[model samples]
Target: MVAKEGYRNGKRALVLLVMTALLLAACTGKEDQGKQEPEANKPKEPVELSIWQTVLNVNEEQFMQEYGSKIKEKFPEVTLRFIPYKGKGSAIQDLIAAGQMPDIIYASVGHIFFGVLDPQLQFDMTELIKKNQFDLTRFDPALIERQKQMANGGVYGLPTSMDTLVLYYNKDIFDKFGLSYPKNGMTWDETYELAKKLNRTEGGVAYRGFGMATGAMFTVNPLSLQSVDPSGDKARFTADEGFKKLFENFSRFYNIPGNEVTQQNITLAKQRELFDKDKVTAMFVNTGAFASSTYKDTMNWDVVSLPSFGETPGVGSQPIPTYFYIANPSKKKDKAFEVISYLTSNEFQQYAAKQGRFTSLNDRSIRSVYGDDIPYFKGKNVKSMFPVKNASPTPLTKYDSVALASLGTQFDQVLIGPKDINTALRDAVEDANKKIETEKGK
Candidate 1:
């Protein structure tokens, strides 16, 4: 009877052990299945990234036709949707109010510098730049430095196109006056002397020597020159030595014997007519004006580096760069950065250069091949667009636009003989300070 009882207990213990083992195996299988399910059900679709550009001329359909295929060839799993916003105020503001923030924002350095597009609204690209080992040296040092300044020492954007000030001369006018073409790397003083030679009344019609578009006189100066001090809420243009020098240099051109007609007399609208239709203007200081189709078939023109100030010998004018900024609120930041990287890549820059678009890259090979694909640029001195260093961007204040306009009016007064340089500058300072205070009150 004792032997039978011991066998029964052993049998019951084996049955309990088998049940426990089966229960443990079931729990382990569920966990394993849970882990594999996510992988098995992962989405296999491509992500679509939206990009917004404020400029009207930039067509998305044209972009997709020209460059979209190249991007797709590289990143098949990513798609780009380009959105064009043509409006007055800040396009970013409109987008934010409408809750339509895109993955990328296209803007000018002026817009970014002046706080139109808030820097905090952009993702700091410094980390991604380091992770991807991007060669910042591939671009002009001034351009990279400008980006840093705009972001307060953080790289928040990348430049797509760089437009620098150049001296555009009418070949016909130069030839008619028996003067040689303006050479690259000439100083403002040397250029002024050349302008004197070209300023004359020919065939009973007045032909001005040298003329610049309204408001472009500021471009030739250093970026540090500002009309107002944001920190102190004061006007700096009156006391700033840079402004004094700028006024003096520009005054020399208009004060010439026959060229004293003043910009107000001719007006901005007539300035282009003078250059294009009348052909009375000999040398003009402009940026990207010669690239227009209006001049492609009509005029004989060539460009040279802008006349530099003797104080800043080798440095040319500040570049007007168009920047591409990544949205800070984007869910596809990594993908957006990839697109920006590809856009600024060597292959893309070369393609852009061929389209007659100025590339921001400092690559000599790309500069050599600039505008080669465009038939209008054939036999033109396209290589002359480069060779000079871009001037550093000036720091900006919130009141810069108003202050600059006020100061510009004062400068115009000086040019038109309504006020002397000192009085005009003093009055401009008071006017700018008042405007700044008004803006602060608002």
Candidate 2:
């Protein structure tokens, strides 16, 4: 009786399997006969790809004109839309709360872990890159390493552009002092010597020798120091010897007699205004002047590579990079990858380079066209923007942003307060770790 029951059950199972196969075959026949349009047509509902980046600090109209329109031209069925953040209210966080993460997200290298990784939205594009046969070698190796540093041996994003540090000098100030313009590949020590010559107060107007808008330059210091250590997952600004070595040397600028950090020029805004609008400062280690400044048209300025250090010959400051990522929750990852891949392509890069935005591509042709279309940059030595080599990218974490912010406070203490360099370094890291812990609680 048991054997008979088993045979009957096996027969029933075979019959059901045959019926299911026949039903699937009939559906396949319908699909072959173009009955799949209903399923396919759902995606035809005006393919809108949302972007959560400023795209070189552009407004909606500007972004649409430059990058958005181009994407529309290629993917005619698609509309590229932006979810702005700069100078806007908490956009990304709101999106996260609403469960509406954008298809493409842009982040500066430092913000990678905070904005993308912490949200658990980082998507490794390695397989997509391989599937698309995208060549990674075209980009500067440092930028590639930066992406890998953000992910654990995975390419989380593709570099779209960079903001490189250079020694921006007021040529008029140099002329006033009878000093020659700084040349490319000058060491920081050489820059310090030049700064000494230019540090003077003539006719009651204080002229600073060397300064920057903020302590941003030191964040990418030539010593290749990073605020946080990935190995230990804590602030490394105090522990790393490189940080002290860099800070010890850089702090000299603040002590250069007339160039001391004062109440008038101590703030970041004042430092930038002094060099840019007031034109009191002679040299500034800052981002390239690519028609970016409102004063660029009026100011007589040129740039050289960010001063290299004696300890690291020919290595420039770490590249300040911005990358494009396809968020993990994005339903249209393929289209997102296609759009971002096109963004990093030769054609788009050329267009971007001409528009005075720095290109991340290692292509000389793109680099040569750095400011071709910008009238203000016609005769400026923009080539000094690219160094012979970029310093190796260091490990980054969510704590990095907090750590860097605290450094500014501790850095101020070094220049003006009674604290020594070592003391300031210790405070910066300690304050940063405390902030990191506070943020962790949130």
Candidate 3:
């Protein structure tokens, strides 16, 4: 009996030992499994990319936020640093000079003109574009060619948004003056006649037929240049009879007696106020300006083709190709290229288009965005404002910048009668050419 009891106790002890061993083995296996994981398996922290933009104005931030935040989410590794142009030109120069440049620089098409002035400062995106099979067909070749004229073969930026100019007229003003609405193919002479009929000084108000932007001559001169070989660099317009006709045509808007319209010291905002107050009957405006005015506000107005100049359709506004540029020699070139590719895609463009009216440089995508029928774009022949046949972008070079600035000043002088049309254009062209020759060191 004693032997039996001892044997039974031994069996019980053996079973307990086996169970404990199994539990210990299981715990050891779990620890070994934990040790086998590689450090790389852990979630990587995102990359933070800084983006600089000009959407800091009070009315602009909301629209910018709609897509700006989406960009941040899409590029988890990127954090956009929205920098506003603080009304200080020196600040931009200083920030850019200090080597603290943002990963992405978003500026106007004008900047691209300046970017090409110095190759070292701008990145050449040719190879990356080829490698990624990025479709350049998405952009207007005319726009692209204009950008290429800035410098060498290196592409410095990609245009994500564009705005073309059109003529905006107040319907009420036309009705009150007993004048028909401006037609799609109306010539400058016709526009002048309409303006003359509409000008009025009554009821404690002086009404002007039209308003002009002093800087607008740079765009207007292109039509005359087109008449003298659009591809040439020389200023044939200075000597061309057609160019004189162009100036005379512009002068009609200002020649009206007792008209309050004067080009000197007038601003876009002031013009808008005039339009709102029914003081100005018509004005030329770009898509950006129009978007800023009509997004949610009620205005009794309509748009039509820019007034024609004889056989040539009136060139209202050129499509300013605002773009994003990556530094070619950037330390983070690969990533920068990726960001650019992503930004200029059709998906992103559609988002921007929905907020404001845009004609895609990519034809197919444009068709997709604006279907075969759109009410606002219907047959007052909206196509007249498109492909701006004579649209000329700013020339790239220090000389071009100086030329444009000098030209703007001179144009203002002509409009205000400080200089005759021929003398002003001649002197301006001579001064500009001299600067150009000096810059080229030829």
Candidate 4:
């Protein structure tokens, strides 16, 4: 059930239910799409594999369950039961506490710190990779890099999908203002001037230059107000002048009189209600926003790279990968790995790319999966994300949630009050360092 469109498509790649009863029967005839097996004279009993993944949206949930049916044809004897959960963290927590961990679990990039940051929670998959003779070379190099960092050669997880952040802008507004489309290398200064210039005042219906998620807070990582130096594991958010300069630019846009935003219908639903209404000039959003923007087919929009600071090369944008990990507690580790391999393999990723989800694991196959040009990407500037490549997680101790909340509190202070940028930054840096030091001692 693959639906193809001009730019976007959907692959309801489904496996027949009958094929599940005869796993190897169809494989003997079909070419090796995945791993090739030497014919064994004796047949072993099939294993039942229980899997769990968080259902954040309708499309993703459907892809998982529906794809499961298709993979069943290749391994009919192996049963895959996918249990749905809500938050990635909560799902894993509940499963762990209940002593009912699934063989495989879908994990968000944000939640990866919870597993990899803690050594005890992770299962060393190095042996499993060797025993199965799993070719680590099959995965994308970027995916392999992150996995190596987290696993420390343990190979605990497989990246399923990749998501990148870009600046989404309205086309009608650009046309009305007689402004040219945003270029890939636009700097923050240029973007700001354009935003200020394009703000139409004809009807006294003031429009904003940009709208950012005030609620989304991060003190570290590439998306944060600060970041660690990739070369050194040291917190450079405060020390790094580059980050400070970026923050200054960020604050300047928000400080604009009309740009001061709150979480109204205008704020919460950024692209749909705000940008589409021609109120906002641009927004920093993920690839998912493209889907929602075009579902109505009324909004004419384009994407560009995020703005950069003065002399530094435009850092481009940051993209996070969607991936899944198998738990060691499962009784069916072998079957679990097989299911994971299938889902993250080029075949399944190609199926997902048809749905317009951001995919980077197998770009060659995605090129074949999609048509010449996707309207969602039409006229949109596509820039590679640099932040994701250099991103490092913030300290995640037992009190990580508390530390984040504290950071949020401080951010609110700066957002609401009249505080000098230097003072605020110094205070935040000192406080965060103190906390990190305390955590390290613990």
Number of the top-ranking candidate, with lDDT as the measure: 2
lDDT of 1 by residue, 274-326 (tens): 77778888888777646644567578877777888777765677777878888
Tens-digit lDDT string for candidate 4 (1-442):
2335522422222344445646776775465544555556346587877666554543445755446766776677777666666555445676678766667766655666554334244566777778878777765565666677666656768777665445667666677778786766677788787777664555666666665443332433243333434343334446756545545666666667666644343333553467655445544433443543342355666566555555544553344566767776767777777777787666766665555554556456563443123445543333232232323333323444434444444554555567666666666556655776676687
Candidate 1 lDDT (Cα, 0 to 1): 0.76
List of clashing residue pairs for candidate 1? 223-394
**Candidate 2 vs 4: which has more TM-score:** 2
TM-score of each candidate structure, all chains considered together: 0.83, 0.85, 0.73, 0.72
Q: Which residue runs of candidate 2 sit more than 4 Å off their true CA positions? A: 1-46, 54-58, 86-90, 289-295
Encode model 2's per-residue lDDT on 1-442: one tens digit a residue: 9999999999999999999999999989988877555764555446788888733355778777657877887677788778777654545677888766799998777677656887788899999999999999999999999887767788999998888777888998889989999998888889999999988888998888999755777677666777877666578877758778776777898789888986666898888888888889998877663346454677898887878877677788788888999989899999899889999999999988888778989999889988888888878888556788888877776677788888878878788868888888888888888888898788
Predicted structure 2: lDDT? 0.81
- Candidate 3 deviant stretches above 4 angstroms: 1-45, 53-67, 87-92, 96-99, 113-119, 202-204, 220-243, 258-273, 283-288, 293-298, 314-317, 357-360, 364-394, 430-442
Any runs in candidate 4 off by more than 4 Å, and if so which? 1-44, 54-67, 87-90, 113-121, 137-140, 214-237, 262-273, 276-279, 282-298, 309-314, 362-416, 429-442
Lowest-lDDT window of 10 residues in candidate 2? Answer: 287-296
Candidate 3 lDDT, tens digit per residue, 1-442? 9999999999999999999999999999999988886876665456655555543342336535544666765666665555555555523455577665666666666555343334345666888889988887778765676557553655777777666656667776777667788776567777777778767866766667776554544543435243122244434446556556666777667778644445633554665567655445455433534634452234566666666566656554456667777754356667777776776777766665544445446655553453123344333334444434635554443444556555555655776776898897787777766666576675
- Count clashing pairs, candidate 2: 0
What's the C-alpha lDDT at position 251 in model 4? 65
Alpha-carbon local distance difference test for all models:
0.76, 0.81, 0.59, 0.56
